[model samples]
Target: MGRGRQKAKHTKIARELKYDTYNVNYSALEKELGHPGDDQYVDKWADQYADDDEELETA
Candidate 1:
């Protein structure tokens, strides 16, 4: 397709998305936003690499 035609099609789709309204799942939104705490993840190699990271920082 030509450039103008492609741009027009994209603009039409963009307008539809901008104006479209649909039902929102508030429970899912709440669940997604409720968790703010860190997962308390531990890296296996973090202890071994800690010395290397410190040396690089010092240099």
Candidate 2:
């Protein structure tokens, strides 16, 4: 495409992104933000540093 047409298309897309508003799925948003729906998850490394804490306490 021509430079003018290319620039115009880019401007149109930028304007749409700048001015557009859409409905947000809040529950999906919460899940994405790390509020898990259950407590069954466990971190395998959660206790990995626990031994270090005891070393410091004894020293």
Query: How many pairs collide in each candidate, listed in order?
Result: 0, 0
After TM-score superposition, what is the CA distance of residue 15 in candidate 1 from its true location, in Å? 1.0
- Against the true structure, whose TM-score is highest? 2
The lDDT per prediction is 0.84, 0.84
| Error of model 1, residue 40, in angstroms | 11
Give the per-residue lDDT of model 1 (tens digit) for 1-59.
Answer: 59999999999999999999988999999989675568666577886655777789999
Candidate 2 clash pair list? none
* lDDT by residue (tens digit), candidate 2, 1-59: 59999999999999999999988999888878774468678677977666777889999
Residue 36 accuracy (lDDT) in model 1:
50
Could you estimate the TM-score for every candidate? Answer: 0.49, 0.55
In model 2, where do residues sit more than 4 Å from their true spots?
37-41, 44-59
